[model samples]
Target chain A: MIRFLSILFILVSNTIFSILEIEILKGSDNLSKVAFVPFGNESGIEENYGSQISKNIEKNMLLFGEFENLAVNEMLSYPSSENDFYYRDWKVLGVDYSVIGKVNSVNALGNLNISYSLFNINRRIKILEGEIVGSEDNIEDISKIISNRIYEQITGLRGIFDTKLAYVINSDADTYQMCISDIDGKNEQILFTSKAPIMSPDWSPDRKKIAYVSFENGLAEIFIQDLQSGERDSIQALGMTNSAPVWSPDGKSLALVVSFSGNPDIFLYSIRNKRLVRLTNHYGIDTEPSWSPDSKKIIFTSDRSGSPQLYEISTKSKRKKRLTRDGNYNARGRYFPDGKSIFFVHGNNGNFQIAIKKLSSRYIETLTSTSLDESPTISPNGNIIIYATKDGSNGYLGGITLDGKARFSLPVKNGSVREPAWSPLLN
Target chain B: MNKVLTSLNTFFLILLFLSLIFSMFSFPKLNIDETQSIKVNFYELIQQNDILFDPPAANTLIKKEAKKTSAINEKTNADETSIISKFKINKLDIKNEITKIKLSKEREDILRVSAIIQQRISSIWIKPNSLSESLIAKVLINLAPSGEILNFSLIEPSSNTSFNESILTAMNKMTFFEEVLSLERKLFEKNFRNFNLVFKSSGEIE
Candidate 1:
């Protein structure tokens, strides 16, 4: 009896100790609105450093989905110093956050002082501030670095502005080639050429390799290409009609849809064990499999339930559950960065709009009203999705914040762009 | 000699059993009382302040108003004046109808608050009972800013932590705030700044 009581006390103490774990603070659902005034480079440098910094910060803030950067023209007042900050001016504009920075010379040392701070307009508090020392030539590089630091301090996710995006650009009507560009759609580097239609280019978890379904050999084949080496090889499989190769979170396997068994089904190929584990064995099409953050489950669109809807399957237990129930076309589902919800393309009345499904309650909210919004790729921060939409005569890659704000288009020169895959943050 | 030795062993065993029995009752009784005392302190503090628990209903209305249409919520807290001096005793019936409408609207607002808070709390790790003082101000301002969270880096992250799990947990847990929505107009839709949330320990749990 004494021993029993001792065990009971130990268990109760353990429970109490466990209950005292740290509790996380919940912020508002409303994303932060920040205005980045172009950095003033007073050193008479040829490059407009302020404009560049503003652009860089804008791209980073947009990618995180948590921030909305106020347009330069929209800001009512410009405050450079503490005296310039009028809280009422910001209050009238409904501006929640404001950022101001300057680039100044540091004597004969040729070092530059880049000082910036993030201010909370609503609370009238400066949330973040820092200064960096860099050479004049390194201002562009320094701006990128500071932008990342500021981004992480606010969004709690690494910024992907410094990361590159690989997309297919229509160089001409007959030429659809794969090109890699900065996240802002700059510094375009053509990686591969395929007038035969290159589709579905996905970044590996580590951002080292790109797995894309290329139609080079007159058939759809999943090719894993080394970004640094430019060496490419196809994943060896039984038959053709394999596409949409999504890398596992561990980067040890690829979850893809293969039609080798005469019907499209989800298949997992292990890079280590060299074994293929077939997950979905249905007659209906099971395509576009995205790995959950845990890498234990794969969510894909299947018509197994009479209409196209999103379904999730456990990689270990092989158990499957339906995620979307609303529409006849709910396909190309991707997991949010936190793995709490899934975002997919929902079609109704012949229009495809972006929709998100809360995994626990299966509540679906249609986000986009624009038709032909195909191939939604969420940023690493899970704040926004960059997808392809038809803009009049051509196609453009545009991004919309998860909260459904103003959509911005990535400038693709004279060509219709599609299948935009936002890369993970580059280390 | 054998009889004496057996008696000695029996005496030792009896003493050990008695000690164990006494400790089993005494130690837990002391510890449980201490924990209970801490909780009682929290309750007393809340009662003294007169701050409501912010029921789930208010949380939901706030969320819908923030998400669906910004116009519907711009004119909040407008009808709180008493109709005392304007010969309004004859118009009491009309006033009662208006009060009923206002009460329902207030209830709806409470429902909205409840919904938003429910989802927010589920994600974040807010300390029990200490939320009103420790987190309410910062969270309300940061979330109600009408924009996405930005510049959310950590200060003095532990050198031992490789993944920065605490920071990630804090960011994921926050979904919305009540104060950010109360501000007028939707001016800055883009940029956001991070708020450093610090927790303080109260004397006891309520």
Candidate 2:
């Protein structure tokens, strides 16, 4: 009996410890790792847009959430052609792909002879290359197309750099401004500014209107602003705390945190009826409601379980189930665009980082190590996450793909930036 | 007595270690008779562009019209066929050019293009399982070198308005020959552009 017990224990432990093979979409999740060397400026032009071109391409790649970018700071050598390409050096650095280009002018038209070739770092061979010409104004555009072409050659996804993001920039405590910016956080234009505190600006499913909580009335109110007309209207809500306005997948309703019955809850307001239907009812603060892609269920932060954790409630059944177990604080979770899992902030050891939990298995994985990481928003493709981080005293936005690589920070000019909601890809 | 217990414990540990080694080294029998098989289409492995254009019904119509005109010309002699035949061909070519021009010019109108473009691309996607209430298929399509749809596939699944099967069905029936703009076929082939089709079934016809 003793021998049998010993053997049984060993078998059980071994079976339990077997490595789980994660079935990932092999080519589907790959982004070409391209390095745009500071484009060699052979021509003494008054301005060199070659570097700008590379940066633009990088921004486009990042926006598409398709390609993993090799940090220029980490590149071993500047290689733009097959001869200069030391694939061994790049492979040693764990890079999977590389891009090199040179920019020069032939005449006054500001002709740029940009020769770039992509290479597979692992196989150590050039994948694709071509020379293109562009004026100074069109260099960035030309570079974007080249980056996209290279992206398609490797990962086969459309480049998203050409896409834009709609967000609300809080100019001051009273002045809440709705704005749209390039994915790199440039070319920001205020669509509409409100004297009230704007909270939770969400992109319309079509990327046109911004639904947000505006406080122009001294009380929290939800407003939807059309990007074109700068026109605004109050979204239908009967209760207080009508914040956390999220557009449903249909764009016909708004899933929001409302508290008309004296307790904050998640409610759905129909755009047609302008009527209210409560989805969650609890005395605890039930806020930060996000709609699943199906609009049949919602994932929101609720304190009904004695602590703030993520909960999923069906819109039809109203059946509630707790989704987080490991963390004492898990709030502000957003469903992946695929709706298979949720990415949220998990507080462990008094530090908050992004954690993902599958809906079916409840398996939890922590993806961020930085403290004070909040508002975890997945890209439109559901392949990466962008969230706010406090790099020391200043809050900056950083992003990491689903596999936990290609970590980079968005440059902030003035004060800290927070609450980045990845907009739907603008056609 | 204590020594005896210690010896027994050592023997147990040794047995445990041996068992672990045996299990690690052994290969379990995966009997053909006992194992069942199910087909799994690994969509994730294929990196196809997600360009979701409606079917090429319009292009088909254009081709049909061209064939019909060519047939009529075959039956008629050069003398019977006045310059009208020549003008008709030119008219058709000009119309094709205009369609291309309209598609590119209309690209700037995001809302209009999205609505109309979706209407033209009408393939329906059925949910594979019952547990799924509905699936939203966002298809991204790449244009072929010939200005026709090269390929298109769905994006994320959303049960909301994004998943309406009726819209997809309607789109599948459309030929966006009307949407194409006049661009050099070479230029079209060299660049990548995406237009989305939002398929939702309100069950109410628009």
Which candidate's TM-score is highest?
A: 1
What are the iRMS values of all candidates? Answer: 14.6, 19.0
Give model 2's share of reference contacts.
0.00
**lDDT values, one for every candidate:** 0.67, 0.65
**Cα lDDT tens digits for candidate 1, A192-308:** 888688888988879888988888788888888888998988887655688888889888999987897568889998877767889989878888899999998999988888899
The parts of candidate 1 lying over 4 Å away from their true place are A1-95, A104-111, A135-138, A152-158, B1-206
Give the per-residue lDDT digits (tens) of candidate 2, residues A119-141.
Answer: 65544557677888877667666
Report the CA-based lDDT of candidate 2 relative to the real structure.
Answer: 0.65
Q: Cα deviation in Å at residue A233, candidate 2?
A: 1.4
User: TM-score, each model?
Assistant: 0.60, 0.54
> How high is the lDDT of residue B172 in model 2?
39
- Top of the candidates by DockQ: 1
**Model 1 chain A poorest 10 in a row by lDDT:** A18-27
Residue-level lDDT for A194 in candidate 1: 80
Report the backbone clash tally of model 2.
25
Off by over 4 Å in 2: A1-55, A58-117, A121-138, A152-158, A166-175, A391-393, B1-206
